[model samples]
Target: MESKAICLGFLPPRLGFSSPHLLSRSPGSSTFATRQKFDSRQTLLWNKPQLSRGRVVCSSSNSESKPETNHSSKSNYARAELFRGKSGSVSFNGLTHQLVEESKLVSAPFQEEKGSFLWVLAPVVLISSLILPQFFLSGAIEASFKNDTVAEIVTSFCFETVFYAGLAIFLSVTDRVQRPYLDFSSKRWGLITGLRGYLTSAFLTMGLKVVVPVFAVYMTWPALGIDALIAVLPFLVGCAVQRVFEARLERRGSSCWPIVPIVFEVYRLYQVTRAATFVQRLMFMMKDAATTAEITERGVALVGLVVTLQFLAVMCLWSFITFLMRLFPSRPVEMTSPLSELLNLDLSDTKKIIAEYIWIGGSGMDIRSKARTLPGPVSDPTKLPKWNYDGSSTDQAAGDDSEVILYPQAIFKDPFRKGNNILVMCDAYTPAGDPIPTNNRNKAVKIFDHPNVKAEEPWFGIEQEYTLLKKDVKWPLGWPLGGFPGPQGPYYCAVGADKAFGRDIVDAHYKACLYSGLSIGGANGEVMPGQWEFQISPTVGIGAGDQLWVARYILERITEICGVIVSFDPKPIQGDWNGAAAHTNFSTKSMRKDGGLDLIKEAIKKLEVKHKQHIAAYGEGNERRLTGKHETADINTFSWGVANRGASVRVGRDTEKEGKGYFEDRRPSSNMDPYLVTSMIAETTIL
Candidate 1:
């Protein structure tokens, strides 16, 4: 017999044989033998030439046993059959080789489809089971023993545990859901981080809920009955349980440990049930001791009472737990770059640093001092570092060797800072510690203490109005992007989402003023979309100026965060829109007493005489805002009338009716320096 070799090009490389092998069949035997090996390249030479009559002929067998003629069509079948055959020992060149079945080499473990029950239905069912039971049981206990202290405690504990446990289970089961991660590793603990984290946690945990109850309980423990305790207990227990679970989960090496808490929870539920039964029996006995008719009536009323208590308790507990989770949130691990560590270096320091100082001196504009570091807990306001600037820069001194010294007069808590920062309001001084001649603040102080002013007991309330402008466009900050909003209607003291803009900044400024110890009376949205007003009421003399300057400083700083520009221009926007103003309302002891309108009119008459002087001192750019087209009186003219917005001076109708009160000098522009305006008013009206 003769044999021929065939090479299959499409065979996978993993077949472990790259060379062609020999295949031979013995006479009268169904099996074939493959042996001998030759490089695949050699087979290519015979590839086109070996086939004759559509069949591959190896060698001649006996004449009676001819090679199959249809072998070409069955070539693929024959190759597949060869690979399917079981392994058998074969001898080739005195070496034994075992040919293994191809199927055995390619076998893999079967993967069964995961059930939806485990992934979705199981968690929902489990959470529902845990939460529903507690809710129902709590209602039952509260209904049966409304005034029982032990029952309250037990039910509270049970309800809180189940609710938190359900939350924990839900979180665990839904662990695959993606969550936002914070990278605190690169962030060193500092004021901003500390405050942000504290605020975030407080807001999450409904800090008011926890704090109000705790404070009320502490302050009026005797008055707060068992209800207070019941209300607080769930929040306390939920927080404790969540913390414990978190700690255990962190240290645990296996999943089995979580099951222990579950067992304890079951036991707690049983105890709650037993306590409820005991309280129910006691309540029934107490009811039985009363009249039969009263018992019947009470029984009928108890159902509604139980529902109301249950609903309130559940709402309170749920809200408490929800906020608690927010407070103590589970954060994801985050990756940060190496550069973040260097960037966040300032956060590592605990000491408060003086970042910037504000100087309000000769110039009407706010002069910002260069940022510098200062120690925390600055005990003495006098001890604060004095800043010096070129007096010429503020248009207060000749361009020579003269330098203006900023003498810190007062230190207010910096509301814009998350840490210990102080806002120092300063007066311009000379090297000799004498007040600078050009410092209006010092001038105002002198005028306030003058003998003529001291006897009048003059009080001032300044209504400061300003517009918020978008940084780049100069349009009203809250106005629509390109076009104007609805014309000057319905914006004053506006409520609702659509009508208001910049209320957040307004609110923030209001809070900042209050925190800075300024006598800020109130704030309201103004006539324009982005315009707002804040009032400083009844501040005497220079106190008004000092507080107003500080308040303006705070307002500017707050707007900086909003990326908006504050325009104190008398008419921030021209045309039909109303211009901004710091309308000064003033009253003396005589003006406040009986028959004060005549004194008010006398003051107004004097103001009319110096209208030009007051207008010049009111603010720069007063022409555009005081146009008679808007609500303001013309800049070149002066008039006074009762309850007249169009007049330069508006005496309130109440001032007219009561014959005593204050008159409003409505001519001052929004940008006017409060000190200069107040001093001028005091000098003209009182002094």
Candidate 2:
């Protein structure tokens, strides 16, 4: 008998099979021997099989006779190979073909499971149905006080425990219909995918049940027959609206949907509590009831009943929603990856150049910039060529014909631009390139580089305070209109819905300062509501004013988008409220050395001599802010004390303890030009 090999090609590993194999066997016998050669797709034959049995035979040459079974297998494999093209090959076998067909069937349902619009519409309908009947019952109870408590308690019990809970049970049993609409997956906390959803739902339910009814009783004390519907309707409508909005956001895979509802609810709760307290006082003063003691007892009982019923209703609704969500989970959404914005280009061998020109003017009131495309960046910033501008436009010259040359002293990266842009801080000079005699930045730089103090290396830390005001009413951004907010007691560094506002602007300014390399120390909410403070520290030479001006410019630009005005007014708001101040903390190398406290006192004494001059440049409207009230010194006289805010200059207590450190000039109003103030301080204190 001649030896023969049966080559059986297997499917890919994805179809759960290994490589092709060759089985060697004698003619007309089932017994086989293995000859493993898995590298090539083409099979080789050692010998031809006998034509005695109806068995398949594969041949290497076309001259050999082909068998029916082998021919069918070859055709199927050829078709698969053609479908995959030249880069791919497929080996078809009886088992592999069946498995591939079954996989298609298995994945078909998942592909067809795209979310439907009905999921969003169904919840809106259900919530509306629940709230409509409450309005009628509330109205009926408001009309008749005799049956008010019983009506409210029964209405709440029926809606919450009976109807709402029954609906939840119905949805849970028939989850197939409701699951698709409610399915969601939490993106932030992967370990507990739906944990936030659960917690938030629970809180919303609690506020509706316990907080609202108790608040109702507290508000309508003597009458004890207030309309619960009117108070609760807004809450119900708001919840329904929020749910609809959240569903839309969820479909788009927004992480913010879960947080926003909670914030709104908490704020609503606070408003309700506040209103109830106010109403109680109003009722008491009016003497609305014959016996206040009797009304109070009945009010307590009614509140308890109302709370119990409302709790049951909210619990039922929450349960229904939770069950539907678990049955059909939402698919993860694909988000766009954040790419770093390039701010500089590598053009070392390129011919093009880009630069930005920045200058200070308006009596050092503003820092302005304009882009200029140049042949190349300045080879030496210290020797930058002077540029000219219309000095009259910037309030620096007497007439329009007069022009001023801008002398660039320092250069920095323009943090807000998204290219290789440079920020040039320049001082004003006469058209002939002579330094402008009255320019504050030039004066500050000259004083800083004076021979008497040039070697001391003076450093400054300026604490800048300002307020954000709404554009329309001109009131502080977060303050209540037509009245004040809780007397401004709880706003400083406070973290809550009521106490903090305009944090987004503050945060943006801080980041901009940091990116600009401004040496900004930190920021915090100030004593008065809507007043905020930021500090710049260890800024040496004239760089202190340079960085401060840049920082202020960034703040003003960021607030412009929101129609918010940044007010550097010393007393943005008058009365018992604290005024804003730019307290400048200064230290020299000698002032920080041993026995520096005496040197600090000596500087203070010199400051006393120039009190009138310092106050004059401290900023306009200083007298309104620096009165001997609200942590301010008497503006008429100069006084220095250790850690005393109510003084002209406050010497740090640590400086007194260590016998060395720095002193803060607290008399500078918030609106003072930092350049002018620092210049005077250096001229008076550097001995």
Candidate 3:
């Protein structure tokens, strides 16, 4: 912003330097207004120590009019007049002018394709040589295990090797050839350049496979099993050789040779495809005219892919070699183990047995029968039982009514003797039977009606029990869903009545307790104390074969006369197919048993008793299903431990204003005959 008038003295005639042009500031105040190339030329006055006289003569008359500028009286006159308010003289030397020019100078740009060929071809040779050999080796090993003919195996190996090698080689060469076409001149798309670099480098890695394997073989030649050793130790040995080679190269000061960039070029090609594309061939040519030292973005992207491929190849090869070693076995694998000695097992021996033994089932990776142990976790017992071979042949007793029915032979078989019971229990269970009529055990009473009913005014009762500090707390009693304010609060007690007990007077004193706050006194507390516990206990450890058939038969016979049934202890006995004993449609001889009919009926009665007990615990006269209010059940009271002191409880609001509560008790009131008879409908639908 400082403007000083400079004195260049007076111009000589024909020296050809016009009045210096006015320097107008540019549009952006931050930078110089205008920039022009400096025109360097020598004026006659420049070489002379004396100023020009001709240009002064022409301005003599005009200068006389301004007498204040005529200060020739003193030797310091020129210096003083140079910076006068109206005018100033500018004195510039060659050195100062040159300095000004230098301040505005710039550097040259970057290049894209100078050494792309070398960058591409080297990796091509390397990656191809490496990947092809393994493919062949894998195929040959597989064929050998399959016991293919000698000539066939040899041919397969040769063809596989050649094919993979050719593919790798072509890919490498192609990447190298295409490197020039993909340039990194424009930084906008650096990805293309990088892919070219990666593809090139990967091709070079193929050489590692060849050289490393050869070096390993040479070093371990003195070993007893050098061939086998090389096969297993190729990757480690190759890496070791590569490290030593790299170190020597570094020492020789030739580590930055162009070979790396060439290999890197191939890798860049792959990255461009998977990642992004940058710089085209045309733009690269322009950049190439300048510096070739800058790393193209494309080069970086390609190198990433190449490095990944290298590491992946090493890991895969190592795993494969380990697998091969496992198949062949090592010496003295076991020293003093009795089991190993008894089995006389070695790695090779084990592999043979596994090949012969492993079998797949209907489910993928699921093993069946004895041979089905190889693929996965243990099979579900409910879906698959072990095969049993006992009693007469399946054909011999196929028609016997007092014998076990057998499934025909198969590749795999179920292994359970006849007459086994299978009991399955899903967690929460709703009990079947009447909720009211507390002590009523009507063998033929209607499920909806009660034989005896009590009439009394509805009264809410509190259940007093010792809590955490053994302090008596009044908990609301009954089925939570049907009770007042429901069982959704943070209290262990619920109030309501047992609907199954009867329809007359509302029952009271039912307690809604969460399962977690419970202290079950029996069965190691492994099972939740609920209707399901009693339902599943009968079949818990029993198997399916003859026992199951007899149990089914007894259940069918009981259903003809009774509404519900269960069995505690069942023992099979021979009986003829007659009248009530012959109720089942099954012709299996195992089902034609005596006394099983009576035992099954008794089991049903026991379950009914347990159901009644659960109902009573909820409360007597609590009209709630099980032991709560109305027809609703509070599952939260039992499912979660929200009722105990310091327990969590949650309640939801129904804005719809509907009278029906969301919670329904898990009792027959939810639906009578939920069990025993529910499966019958599903079975009929299936049939």
How do all models score by TM-score?
0.49, 0.51, 0.15
What TM-score does structure 2 among the candidates reach? 0.51
Model 3 worst lDDT window (10 residues): 466-475
- The candidate scoring highest on TM-score is 2
For residues 1-687, write the lDDT of model 2, one tens digit per residue.
Answer: 001122222222211112121111123333222122122233322221221111222222322332222212221100011110011122221111110111111111111222233334445544444555556655665465456345545554444433333333223222222221122234422212466776686677655555655565455544545444433443454455456555644554432344334433443453344334333443454456656666665556445535533454455456445534633363322121122224344555665455666777664556566666666656456756667777787777878566888777777666666344566777778866677755778777778889877788888999999988754224576654223567867999988867987898899989877877679999999999988999998788788988887788778778764456788878866567888899999999999999999999999999999899999999877898889888899999889899898999998889999999999999998878888998889889985
List lDDT for all candidates, in order: 0.59, 0.59, 0.24
Model 1 Cα lDDT, one tens digit per residue, 1-687: 001123211111111112221111111212222222222111111111111111112221222233333212221100111111111121111111111121111111111221223346436845575668665887788787767676667666665556556655554432211000010111222232345664564454445434544564454334334544554445445445645764544442222233333433343343334433443553576553656765554444333333333443444455444434433443211213245566445632767666456676444665455555786656466888888888786677778756888877777776755356667777888888787765788888889899889888889999999887755324466454223568888899998766787788899999888887789999999988778999998988888887888888888777665556777767655446787889999999899999898899899999999999999999877787788766789889998888889989999889899999999998888878888999999999876
Give residue 567's lDDT in candidate 2 (0 to 100).
Answer: 80
Error of 3 at 380 (Å): 28
**lDDT (Cα, 0-100) at 52 in candidate 3:** 15
Q: Whole-model lDDT for model 1 versus the true structure?
A: 0.59
Residues 1-687 of candidate 3: C-alpha lDDT, one tens digit per residue? 000112222211121222231111111111111111111121111111111111111112123332122222222100111111212112211111110011111111112333344445545656655456456565666566654234333433453345334433443333222221221111111122344654454445545544544454454344312322323242343344334433433332232222322332333233222211111322343454553433343333233433533453563454344333432342222222336454443433232211111111211111122222223222233343222221123222223431321121111111111011112111111123222121111211122122121111111111111100000001011111101222223221222232121111111101101111111111110010101110111110111111222222222223212211221100000111000001011111111134333322332333343444434333212232222232123422332111121111111132112221111123322111122222221122111
Candidates' RMSD to native:
31.9, 33.2, 39.4
Q: What TM value does model 3 have?
A: 0.15
Which is the winner by TM-score between candidate 1 and candidate 2?
2
